[model samples]
Target chain A: MSETLQYIGLGIMSVLNGPELFSIFGIGVPVAIVMLMGGLLTGIAVGATPGLAGPMAMAISLPLLISAFGFTPDALLPVFAFLIGIMKGATLGGAVPAILFNLPGTPDAMMTTLDGHPMAQNGQPKRALRIAQLSSVSGDTFSDIVLFVCAPFLAVIVERYLDLPEKTALLILSISFIAAVMGASVGKGLLSVSLGLIAAFIASGSDLSPRLTMGIPALREGFSLTAAVLGVLIVGEILSTLEELWRNKHALKVKDVENRGAIDGLQRGDIRRIVPYIGRGAVVGTMIGALPGVGSTLAATLSYTLARRRHRAITASEDPQFGTGVPEGIAATEAANSAVSGANLIPVLSLGIPGNAAAVFLILAADSIGGFNPGPAVFTFTENEINPQLVTAFGIFTLMALGNLLNWTVGGSFMRAMGVLAKIPAHYLLPVVLLVAMTAIYFQETSMFAIWTTLGFGVFGFFMRKMQVPVLPFVIAYILAGPIERSAREAFSASGADPWFLFKSPISVAFLVLSLAAPVFLSRGGKKPS
Target chain B: MRRINQNMALGAVIVALALFALFAWVPNDTVSGFVESKRGRLSIGDAMAPGIAFGLMALSGLILLLEARKGDMPGALEQRTFAFLLVALTACAVSFGVMIWAGPLAVAVFGGEGDTYRNLRDTAPWKHIGFVLGGTGLVTTLIALVEKRVTSNAVMIGLAAALALVGVFDLAFDNLLLPPNGDQ
Candidate 1:
């Protein structure tokens, strides 16, 4: 307890003592803080815009920051602070469009649109925004706190107990769980996952003589992660949206409302009522977030579904259904999604694996920058010693706290403003988004190859969406497949006369069985969510 | 005109792809200049792509075929839009192909620095970006205009977008190492 308190005190001291205030727009702020604010500002802007996403912003910023900072120890904190800020800011910012315009800015924000748009149409935009803001910040703080307290301990436990077979089985468990979580039919979900595994396999051979390059020079280089992701998620979204507009000729824009509240932020009574919902969402989100590969969409969807169920139970014949712009609906979705921003980093920091796409940028950046590979080794300590990486992790937690504070203060009004702005026509907005996507791709990879890759994936994504195959399963599977394969191979090599090496460990056996059964269970798990 | 059934069309494509992946890919690679030794005994790693692709194709094919087998009326609205999307996709791919592959050829025929191919490859974001933006924008605008889905000012909008994108990319990301357009 004393050691924990001492570390917290030292973490605060480290942040306070280092770095003088630097000029951002000529206003003096600490370099670290400014980067945080700058990234947060950029993320909110990107997240508010329907066609753009936070991952795109992170991908675009990473190379620029790497070049500017020039691979120094001092540079790491500022760059990471900026990234952490963006990750947090984007989650909350998605709610802006989801609420006012009924357009989900990101996939996870799909739940937000249910109640948020209705609330806006009903002239309670302010109330909805306030509920969203409160829930988001609270959930983020809760998850960050959990991450700060838990990651080191979790890393130690895993480092001690988990063998290669266990790790492989765990990954399989994650894949199965994620496949189950995705709403697509079992076959489609499995197909998406299998395709991702195929993509990973294509580029990941030790011999590296272009295994499945199909004789294309570029294919031999394999797909750039950023390009593939942005292409499928953002560029594909752009193409899809454009197709929608093409169908309509002029897709009607949601008319702008006041986008502010008559009453101030949440009332005391309202806060009291919402506290339990926020708590539930935060708990669910943190648990999911700490897991290796499952992501924010499930958290948000599950929480929203649970909230609706709870509401249905409370008022058996209630006039207001859950989707009728209820504050609880906004609270549940925002809290759950926001909580994911912090908790997703737990596995990334503790183990080497990034849990989701947002965290992938951090791994990508860290790998390129060199000198720091974030895994269990980063958490090791001896007698009378402190782990430097642990200290940095604590510092990161402090940075996130500041981000949360910024979100509460300036983020609320900024979100309100975007609520009004999000109603702008897609035709005007999407062209610029496409341009930005291209520029980001080019600047990062410095190759037209990356741009073409993105465009290709965008078309592929369009088809995948049309076919009703869930994209998240594909993404999650892609990220984990290499690790799973590597671990399984290691286990195979390590086997001491055991042909069924994976089935040797009871934990592995149980998890593998679960891996096979989870999808079947999910398929049978009643269609009515919750 | 009888509307082509999208499900049936999709199912046929998937089945064809699955068959190609399962049967033809490995044999074709072996026939080509690839190592006959490696091709003769394919590893699990090597087979993963074809195996998975074929499986995915089969699953998608089955789903789409099932949908088609169950007699259903086509949503008149969706068929034309879906067809239009395919057209748009074709336009995009064609423009992209030209932008990347045909830039040097265009330079060779028209005008540019010496070693047109090398220059096109080296000055990727700056020189080649011009081809990409210009070609993609032109094709996209022309299609949109022809479909009457977009206004005639699409050309102007495309031009403005090109200027803005190139300018911002050049100015802000100096560290991006993009070669300056048109000879150094």
Candidate 2:
């Protein structure tokens, strides 16, 4: 208890004395606040917009901030604050369209609409929105606290396994886990992952030259992550959307409704009704988040399905109805998704294996900056390089808590405000999305090649959608490929190219066994699909 | 189903081309030369013996296969449109390759048909030609002007400014760009 107090005191002092905090007063607190507000607003705008998630916005803004303001720690504070605000805001805001228009703002918000829209239809929009906000904020705060406590502990354990072979095995295990959890067809998932690995390999550096350039001078430096991601995710999604439009000329019409009002805060009855469901969802989401490849979406779906089943079983016994515009439905989804937000960071922070596309983007961004590394040694390596005054793992927790608190207090009002945005026409919205994507790609390297690559990837994305292939595995595979290949190469070199040596390390053997066993076990108890 | 099968075959061929580029054209010249040199050290009799054995085996197999099944070649018109598109695409690729030496505008003009530009309001041949030439010229000139005006130092400064912007957002807000790159 005393140690915890000391740590808390140190964290508080560090925040107070940090250069970032000092610079704010010099610039005037009002000006700093305004800048932070601007960042928050911008984050909300980007987050609520499809194809403009948190990472992309940061990528687009980071270079501009660096070039405009220099590398002062003070300048970064507001931006970071804004990103967190945006992440929290956008997630909640996503359900606005999902509830009112039947269109999800982001893919992750799909499950929210299931019961949320029904409540809205039943003239209880405010109630539904309130429950979602409360559950979401609660889950988010809970997870952030967990992250704050667990990161250092996990970091400590990770530091001891910083060798090449272990890293390689860990990466392999991560890939296997991801492939297993992503979709129903393991063969297709593995194929997609393998394709991503092959693509990354084609761009990796070799002693003679960067591989597979075909004497093209432009490609000599290899493909940039920004370019690859833009191509695969943004451009691809757009092309796929366009193809859908081509196939189905008519748009699906949804009923338009006005924002009713703020959520009358949850009643005691509501709390009692939702607590068990929220708890279950949070536990499931966190567990899913800890694993590689199994992201929040799967967690949300699994939790929702499980909640429905449990709700049914209980109601069947008691002669009660469940899942009909109930707060428990909202609780299940909000808790599940919000819990995933923190849990997903576990693998990335601990093992340097990003569990999802967004996590992959964050890891890539960290690598570009000077202070951090992704592997097991990050905690120790970063401890020395990072400014002691800026060491704010605790502060991060505080901010996350504050962010969620703000979300809970005013979440309903925020959702109502977001409804005003849903009126924008697709034509206008899509063009802005295209422009943002173009500017982001251009800023990454200021090369026309990246733009063309993005366009090409858009076409590829369209085809993949048509083929019913999941794109997530491909993204994870691409990010993991370089690290896995590099680590494997290093491990091979260390072992004098003896393949058996991969299993020689205890960590490697353990991870390999787990990787092999996961599929068999996960698939065993689940009912076979009809 | 037949059309889809043909498309898949075409995809296979395209894949083959890509693989050749990856494995053969992209390898280090020294590596290729070393492999060739080692192969050349082998005796002619050693190489010829294997070739003869493989050829005899193939001949025997082919004779037996001729007795088992036979098939006719595809009709020329069955995939005439697809064949034409493939040829056109191949020509476009060749033109892009040729433009590396001849320059972009020159190839765009000489390699293209007048019908390609026929949709333009400028009906006169010279006007159509002038549009292509003038547009290319203007772009090239503008690029040159920008290059001349912006010194290397200025470009470097611009890059530095961009980096600082990224640093500010990352450090202050904790919102990061992407993998292993941003604050976790």
Candidate 3:
């Protein structure tokens, strides 16, 4: 415990006393903290826009940041600080458009539009925004606390008990669980994962030689991770969205509703009314966030449903229902979704598995920045030397706490002001975004090969989406491919070439069994017909 | 009642491909098979992981095919989707082509026969030519495709966006180069 406290102190000092951005009164401000503020503001701005979100912003900023800082140990904290700030700030900022414009700034904020829009239309826009801000911060803080408590414990446990084969089995189990839960069917999800694995396999192999290159020289060094990921997640989405907008060109535009200016502060008893919902949402979001690949959308949906059921049972008939402008609804959704940001890092920091798109970017950052590799080994406590990864982890936590502080202080007003972003036309914005994304990738790689790879992946991603394949599973599987193969190879070699090594141990056998059983049970249990 | 589902049909295709990987591609493409023995010790070969992945793909494809009787997969692309993709790809290719060749062509045209584009690739007017023009063209063309017509406002916005990007990537970061410029 004392050691943990010591590491925490070192982490805080590292963040506070790092290379200075500038000095005021002979006191230098740390670069990481300043970047945190910058990222938070940028995140809020982007999240307020209809078509933009946190991950896109992170993806665009990553290459630029890497170029600025290079791949150095000192770069990790500032880079991660900015990314985590974006993750937190975007969660809070998403509620703005949901309330004011009846548009969800982020996908998880779709639930917010139900009650938030009504609250705004009823001349309580600021009240709704304030409630969202408070609830989001409450949930985010709650989950950050959970993350701070849980991640180290989980990582320690994983590191202690999981051997090579068990680790391999655990990875397979994670993939199976993700495949089972995402996409239309388990089959499609597995197919997506397989394709991703194959893609990752191309131009990559054991030290012997490259596999699946098909004689292309460029294939010798596999596709650029950033280009491929951003292509699918950002560029493909842009293409799809633009296509939909073009198809619906003749559709009627939504007329802007006049705002009824009224006193907009939360009235007495409002906090009391929403506290229970917030608590429930935070719990639900944290639990889901701990699981790899289960995202905040599910958390918000589940929490909103549970809150609605309880609200209906207790409230008077005229007090307002879940879908029609209720503070409780906003509280539930904002709390649940915002809570997901911090807890999502649990998987990334503990298992080195990304739970969602935001976490994926964090993993990419770690991979690109070098020096910091997140996994069970990250939490290793050593007596002789300081574990740098542990310090980085705690430094990340400090940055998250700072982000939450910023969210509490200035995030609300900034979010409210960002409602104007929702008015930007997608046609104009998307093309420019595409251009910028391509340019950014080019500047990073300084190779047209990366640009072409991005375009190729973007096309594949577009078709994959059209075919209803889940893109997240593909991406996660792609990232996990290298690690999974390494684990498998090590386990195989360690077991004296035991082909059934995954089944040799009880823990691994259980994990393998669960990997097979998850899709069958989950698909049967949860899959709904389209 | 059992019509072929598009996803299921795609699954069948994937199954065939996976089978090819297992039976043909993996054996031929990889130097060593699933397992290799070197110095009397055993190790997993490069083909092992892909072989496993392809096997999994085959299994999942079979499952998809089996489920085909239940329902059709949603969100299948229409003909117009392909059309849009074609136009988008064409625009990208054209813009890229222009980005690559425009500066060199302009240098050859404006400068005397002795002055080459390679000499002036990093200079002000020459360096900015391809990225700004190609980027603006790409953006403007995409907007036109979406709006079904070209508008001055769209062109202006596209030009402004391209310039801003050049400013951000080039002027701001002296180390960074725009597309084609980096290639050159």
Candidate 4:
């Protein structure tokens, strides 16, 4: 306990003494504020628009930030903050179109339109928007707090027992966790995971001719993480979205609304009604976040499902009011998604394995700029090399907390202001996003290859989405495969070809046992296989 | 589809086995031998023959079986997209062949123009062409720039550029007619 405290103290002191910490706090905090405001405005615009989404916004912003700022840590801070802020705002922003226009800005926000648009037709647009915005802020703030508190505690424990064999076991455990947590069938998930592992293996380097390449000189150095991620997430998603556009060209278009208005203030009754559901959703979201690749969308869907089930069980006497764009639905969805943002960072920070595409990009950015290879060693290495700078972690949490708090305090009114701003045409938005993405990819390595890869991946991502194959496994596997392979090799070297040596260590034995048991436990209470 | 899955699984197992064999039987001393050979002190043929020979044999056995099975698979050419993919694959191979004499940039420009820009317009043809041209030019320029600025050996940058381009293309063409590029 004392040692743990000492480490925490050291972490704090490291932050306090470091010049970079001061610079980060000084520059990052204010820039974060500006970006948050800008993102909030962008989110409202995108959310109010017919076809745009939070992820699209993120993809567009990612490249622009990378191009404008390069891979510097200081540069990443505000961008990440903006991303988080926009995601929060967009959740509510999406409800605008869902209500007034009978269109959802994003797929996950479709549920809101069920009752929201009906309420708008009934002349309760203000009430519906109020409920949605308030519930969203409540959930988002709650989840942010959960992430801020939980991640470091998990990190501390992870740091204590992290070693080569253990790290390898942890990686295997992450793969298993992802497969278990995925909404897809186990067979499909396993296939995707296997493919991801194979992809990573192909991209990995060897002393004599890089692995798996058929004498292609360009492949000798292996694949770049930034390129791979951009390809899989942003590019893939764009392609998929485009395909949807092609297929659904004649789909019913929502009539555009004339006068968009702001959400009214939430009543005490509304707050009281949603408190329990919000708490449950936040907890569920945070837990899902901790698990690799089980991101916010899944978290929100699961939480809503669970909330609905619980509501059904408890309110048997009354007609179950779930999925009615009620406070509970908004609370559950918002909390779950917000919590995931923070929870997704746990594996990335603790194990150096990114849990999602966004986290993977952050890891790559960190690698390129900070020269800090994330893993078990990051804490130890940073403690010794740049201990004074470690305060940035603490500051990040604080800033995240502050950002969420600020968003909550003024978020509803801001949303009200945003309804007016959502009138921007898609033509203007799409080209800007494209330009930003292109520029960011160009800056990543200053190579055209990265840009092409991003575009290509956008298409692939699109297909994968259409095919119902989860992309998270691929991203997670790619990020973790290197460390897992390296750790396994080291463990083998240390144990001198003894297979049982892995089991001989108590730490490794315990981790392996837990890893083996996770699938059974997760599968047991899992929702009836979709 | 089931047969393809089965074959893929079998190929994976064979590759795993081959890797295991290399890890077990191949001597660690070959790393030094390769380094020495590269520095012109000794020929890799003499110094690392055992490792290289064993590795080649194992790799060939795995590849041949996989390829034969892949070739025999039904509906291999049924998809026009798959046919286009094959053409792209052949173009890449030809470009690599050309690279031996023409160097990376010439082959890259030719490959880019032939494979990417020759297709029909789905969205904006000029936009797509611009994307391809800019992408190819960026790769070539980066290799040249990096060679001058960092390493004099443009091979490393060229290789990096090629992998990026191929990765993007592979993602764009989701069909599995062409094997994934070995290096990512």
Q: Individual DockQ of the candidates?
A: 0.21, 0.04, 0.76, 0.04
If both were scored by TM-score, which would come out higher, candidate 2 or candidate 4? 2
- Please, what are the lDDT tens digits per residue for candidate 2 over residues A459-508? 55444444433566777777887677567655665776565756887988
| Better candidate number, 1 or 3, judged by lDDT | 3
Q: Against the correct fold, how does model 2 do in TM-score? A: 0.70
DockQ of 3: 0.76
Q: Rate the local accuracy (lDDT) of all candidates.
A: 0.69, 0.54, 0.87, 0.55
Most DockQ-accurate candidate? 3
Interface RMSD of each: 5.7, 15.8, 1.2, 15.9
lDDT of 3 by residue, A451-475 (tens): 8889889988898788777889999
Q: Candidate 3: give the clashing pairs.
A: none
- lDDT per residue for candidate 1 within A86-156, as digits (tens), equals 88778888888888778777768889989988888777877788899899999999999998878778778
TM-scores for every candidate against the unseen true structure: 0.80, 0.70, 0.97, 0.68
Docking class of predicted structure 4: incorrect
- Predict model 2's lDDT versus the native: 0.54
**Which 10-residue window in model 2 chain A sums to the lowest lDDT?**
A244-253
Clashes of each: 0, 46, 0, 13
